[model samples]
Each structure stands twice: as structure tokens, then as C-alpha cells.
Target: MILREQLITQGVSEKLLDDVEKFKAFYALTDQNLTSRVPQTETVFYGKDIWAMCISALLEEENILLSGPKATGKNVLADNICELFGRPQWNTSFHVNTDSASLIGTDTFIDNEVKLRRGSVYECAIHGGFGVFDEINMAKNDALVVLHSALDYRKIIDVPGYEKIGLHEATRFIGTMNYEYAGTKELNEALVSRFMTIDIPQIKEETLMVILKNNFADANEEMLSQFAGVFLDLQAKSRNSEISTKSVDLRGIIGSLKTIRRGLKPMLAVDMGVIGKSFDQYEKEIVLDVIRTRIRESWEAEDIFPER
Candidate 1:
């Protein structure tokens, strides 16, 4: 109810909300064991339009590919989608070593005979869970071949030596990719064609403020503004190629604030959470320069959450 009301407050369409409610009831989970797969997400995605787009696409059974740079909340939105719709989620991060067996099933010896140990994708498919393919572009092209059948219109899994099975009606897949990451490539045309792409954008300052306030109601308002300013400055610089995306991190900012509430110095927490994210000493210096423009090195917990 809170999630739905939050969406309504954000100006999500009533018609869409109605459909979402219906969709939730219509495909309600029957298998209680899968309840653990439902994400316990703390952050609600803030974009009205993005929420509507993802809801509509998923309601129509289309696969989603969230494409963009870091800190854009692609994975967050994916989690919000699955949580709002009451679906179990299976997340897999792609890498060079990822292969068909890792996604489908591998042969295992059981009861003195060989049996298949189901993988994340297979579990998601058979049980109508949401498959979150993180770093989809990082995997070698050959490693992703196993997903082709399930991703396209076919929506079937043909596991060798196992019975072919159709995806559960409630099954949905959401893939996230960062285009310029090392060892990553643009998704192939064939793979791209299977998904309805959503290009996530950086969080607006106002949106970031709302997220911050929601997470830290007791934090000083002025301090919140300064932290938000720091993030916005980094985001703008990163966008303009003045700085790398390594330091334009919304998650890092939030995490650092949490540590600040736990009695760490405000600037030092930012250093570990935000600045230290980039291992390159030169990049760290550059990010610290941006942060110091907003956060004072002498700031402490009393300066941020003085009421405590």
C-alpha cells in the first residue's frame, strides 16, 4: 500500500496503478518457498515516467534492458519493479567465465545417478521469477547464447538431456549494462532485439534530496543539501567528461551518510565511501576536490545530525 501510494504521490497514472494491482492479484504467488526471492528493497525508484514504462512493458510480458552509466538506479528500478509486482527475483552478474551451464543447469551426481543442478535462470524461468542479468555486456558473447531462446519470443528453455520447458507466465527478465566498462561491449544486435531498452538517466537533484530525506529524516537539512550538491557536481562533471563515472556515485553518497550517522566524521566517511571508490590516486584526488567544494573536512556527526 505504501509503495502504491508513493507512486500515486509521484503522479503515476491511476489507470496504470489499477492494472498493477490487478496484475499483482492475477499472478499472485502460489509457491511460498519462492517468497525469499522477493527483494526487500529499501529505496523506491523516484521517476514517474520510468516507473510507468517499466510497469507497462512487464505487464505485457516484454523483457527489459536497463542501459546507462553508473549511479543511474537501473538495478534499483529493476528491484522496485519486481518488488511492486510481488515477484521473486534471481540475479546473475555476467563475466568472461559465464557459460551455458552456469545459466541453465549443470550435471550433478545424485542418488548414484547424474541429475541436473538448476541454475539461477532456470529457477527464475520455471517459477516465474524476475531474472536480473547484471553486467549483461560484460560476459563473452558465446556465454550468453544459452539465454537466446528464453529472451526472444520463443520464451522456452531447451536444456540438453532435460525436458524442454516453457517459461512461467509471470516470468520476466531485466538486464542491466554499462556500455563503457572495461571488458564490456555493446550488446549484440541479436541480443538487443530481444529486449525493450530503457535508458536510465542520472537522478535529478530534487529526486536525490527526496531519497536522502527518506533515508535520513533526522539529518540536518542544510547538510543534506550540501551532500546532494556534491553528488550533482560530480554527475555534471562526469557527464561532461571532466571526470570519470567512477566517482559520480549516488550509492556511495548514501552509504557514506549512513556511516556518518554511525559516528564517523562526515568528510572521512565520504572519503571511504565516495572518494576511495576510484583506486587510482589521481582520480581519488580529483573526486576529493569535487567533494571538498560541498563538504567541509572538519564536519562531524553533530554537524549533520545535531538533534541526536
Candidate 2:
């Protein structure tokens, strides 16, 4: 089944699903070409409660703010929400350099005439698309102030030197923030108040195993469990301040499994995906020790997956 159907089957209220479909049908009637803006995602968000909260917020026309640690599937849920609602998605990765000009439109000289170059936020607002503001706290408070009006009840964007534009009724913003990450600033109260915040919990062991099995169908249960154990171990260490979060990478584990499927040694594949991501020698050694404790040297592709 498609994502929308899956969401409904997964217990998203039928009423909410009807509303989303109506909105999508109305959007289609407008002739807005938003196919290119839709995000294609392979990952499925598994939490029923989280999905329910997100769907309810979007149905109520409230902006969503997902706060969590790394690998909690924030981006995945954001993408899934847009897919479920049949809305186009605009991903804006915020960093230290992000500013109001970057979120809104800017004037540029095109063919000797000043033309307005619309940014992701501007386009998403006007087209009634889902705007995913990733790592929002990474940007300075002043830079994020531009979103206040758009996120609030007003739903308006006052672009400098341009006509005041009201956001499309279907427009919604999903902001994600990792408060524990280094160099990320605390979100200002005003901005925080504008969003209906949800604290995303780390994926449970059962869910992680499911994700692994789904992604690496060729791998055996033993190897998948081992990888999940290693991931949880790293997460525990990171939580206790024994290690940096650099080693707690869900994507790295999946990438390593793929490499193993390609006939590379398990250790080498793990190193390339997990250990090699850290540049610091000490950090690498710490991660390598963690892996060594979980993965034995004698393991091979055949050991991890007998069918392979």
C-alpha cells in the first residue's frame, strides 16, 4: 500500500485522513505543479503515538516542532507526514549562516533587471507545501525571527521590498532540533511558543530490529540483533557522557550492512561506515573498541547471513 494508506491502517484517525485527502484534492484543483517538490522516502516512521500527535497537529493547522537526539527519525517522520498529507515538501537545513534573506526571497539582477529569487520558505508558503526546517536551533535567534509571523496564527510573510503575502491555508512548517548537539543554540522562547512541540523518543530495540530487517532482508536475525546491540550500546555511552554522539549513527550501521552484502569484510565495512565517520583519533579508537567488543574478527558475510 502507499504511504497514505499505510498511515490510515496504522491508526491515524479516519477523519484526519479524510481532511488531508480533501485538502489534497483542493490543492490539485489549483493547478499548482508540486510534484517536483514532493520528497521520496524509503524509511517508515513506526511510532503510532508520535504519528497520531503529528497528524492531529497538522490537521489543526499548527506548526510542529520535533525535539530529539540524533537518530530518532525526526526527518523521516517529517517526510512521512508530507507524504501522508499528499503535500509537496520543502527541506531547509538551517545552519549558523542561515538568515531571513535565505528563508524569504531576495532580489537579484537577472538580465539587468532586478528579479525576486524565492527561497524554500517562500515557495513552500505560497504553494501550501510542507516546509521542513531541519536543525532549526543551529541558526541564530535573529535569523529565525523571520519565521515568527509565518508560524503564528497570522500566517503571513512580510517580505522586505515585496508585497505582503498571506501563506496558503494548507501551508505547514515542521521544525526539528537536536538540543544536545554541540554548537546548537537554544531556541528562543518566542519561536518555541509558536510551535506545538513533540519530544521524539529514541527508537526502541524492537523497532530498530524491524527497521534493520526491513532494510537488510538478506541479513540473518543474529547479525541484525548484534548490530542493534552495538547501536544501543553507543547510545547508552553517549547518554552517560562516555562518548560523543558521532559514533551513534543509524545510517552508518545500514551502510555497513550494505557493504557487507557487497562482500567486503565485516570489520572493514563497519569501520568505513561507523568508525571512519569520526576524524579524531581518540574518538575513532573509542568507537573501534566498542565495535571490537560486539563484532568478532572471524565473522564474515557467510557468518552474518548464511543465505549470502
lDDT of 1 by residue, 120-222 (tens): 9999999999999999998888878778999988899999788898999889999999886789976788888999999887789788899899889999998
**Candidate 1 CA-lDDT value:** 0.88
Question: What would the TM-scores of all predictions be?
Answer: 0.93, 0.90
lDDT of 2 by residue, 161-247 (tens): 788789999899999999989889989999999999999987778889978987888888887899888888888888898788888
Error of 1 at 113 (Å): 3.6
- Backbone clash pairs in model 2 (N, Cα, C under 3 Å; residues 3+ apart or in different chains), count: 0
RMSD (CA, Å), each prediction: 1.8, 2.3
Q: How much lDDT does each candidate structure score? A: 0.88, 0.87
C-alpha displacement of 11 in model 2, angstroms? 4.5
